[model samples]
Target: MRGWITFAVMSVVTLILLAPIFNIVILSFQGPQTLSGDPVWTVDNFVEIFTQTPVLTYLTNSLLVTLGTTVFGVVIGALAGYPLSRLRNRFARGYSLTLFVVQGLPVIVIVIPLFVVFAAIGLADTLSGVAIIFIAGSMAVTCWMMASYYDSIPYELEEAAWVDGASVFGAFVRIVLRNSYPGILSAAIFSFLVAWNDYLVAVVFLRSESNFTLPIGLQYFFQQNSTDWGPVMAMSVVMLLPPVIIFATLNRYFSIGGIGGAIK
Candidate 1:
């Protein structure tokens, strides 16, 4: 009886969470009604978004920025995190605490100053500028997350590798990183989502339509008097696909038990 009740509760919660997504999917397929007042279903929304809009360009820009952010965040996070995890010195502790504090601060606080700096440096109005902001904004949390995961890994594994004449960096690459797939994926996803979904930073920094990310490009679907919700939802669906696909593909790689036998 208890198990059945729990299942029922979870089912209700799942429906509640999925209701908005279900509506978006449904609306993406909906079209203008027939003369007889029946609803018309068609793929015209997706077709129109492709043909009539610059959505493909926006998608390409988003992909480039997101991919760049993910790679940089993972590499930098791994390097910074390994040290923080292995060392128990005062500087390491202080740096970790600094990261924690920086993570708590809002991104808006640095927008103006960053804009000024980027403008002077000729990075303004560029996709690369947006990516730089995404990388910097997400750095603190990425470091913290990678460091926490590294903490869970056994340091003795590295010691064993060292005994085999492997350098510290080499042991990190072979043992720590080889077993750190889950952590790497987590940081990548975070960085990807930040770069992909950011509107404020993109809008503030990007002046040309050619460099606009998907989040900013979606606004073109709206007009002065009315909004074309069909295309809006379709573009939103397009925006949703990359993250969904990434999560689905990477879901199997996220296992906590892989490191259990590494020591023995």
Candidate 2:
């Protein structure tokens, strides 16, 4: 009875969470309103968005920025984290605390200053500029997450590799990183989401339509008097695909026991 009740509660919660997503997908397939103000079912929304808007260009820009952020975030996070996990010094602890504080800081706070700096440095209105901001915004949290994951890994494994004449960096590459896939993926996912879904930073920094990410490009479906919600939802569905695919493909790699038995 308890188990059945728990399942029922969970099902209700799942439906509540999925209701908005379900609505977006359904609305994306809706066609023009009939004389009676009813929406007819059609694929015209998808076609219109593809044919009329530069959604493909937006998608490409988003992909590039997200890919760059993910790769750099994982690499830099791992590098920074490895030291924080291994070191027991004052500087390392202070740095970790600083990261924690920085992670809590809102992105809206520094965006103006960053815009000024980027504008002066010739990075304004560029996709690369948006990518850099995404990386910077998420890097602190990524480092902390990577460091916490590294703590779970047995340091003795690296010690054994060092005993076999592997240099510190070599041991980290062959042993530590080899077992750190879950952490890497976690950081990559965070960075990808940041770059892919960011509207504020992209809107502030990206001036050219050519450099606009998907989140900013979605505004093209809007007009002065009326909003074309179908294409907007279609673009939203398009925006949803990458993250869904990434999570689905990488779900199997996220295992807590990935490092289990490495010591024994």
Model 1 TM-score is 0.95
- Give the TM-scores of the predictions, in the order they appear: 0.95, 0.94
lDDT of 1 at 174: 87
lDDT of 2: 0.87
Q: Which stretches of candidate 2 lie over 4 Å from their true place?
A: 33-38
Residue-level lDDT of model 2, residues 91-195, one tens digit each, is: 999998898888887888989999999999999998888888888788887898888888988888999989999999999888888888888889989988888
Find the number of clashing residue pairs for candidate 1. Answer: 0
> Runs in model 1 with CA error above 4 Å?
none
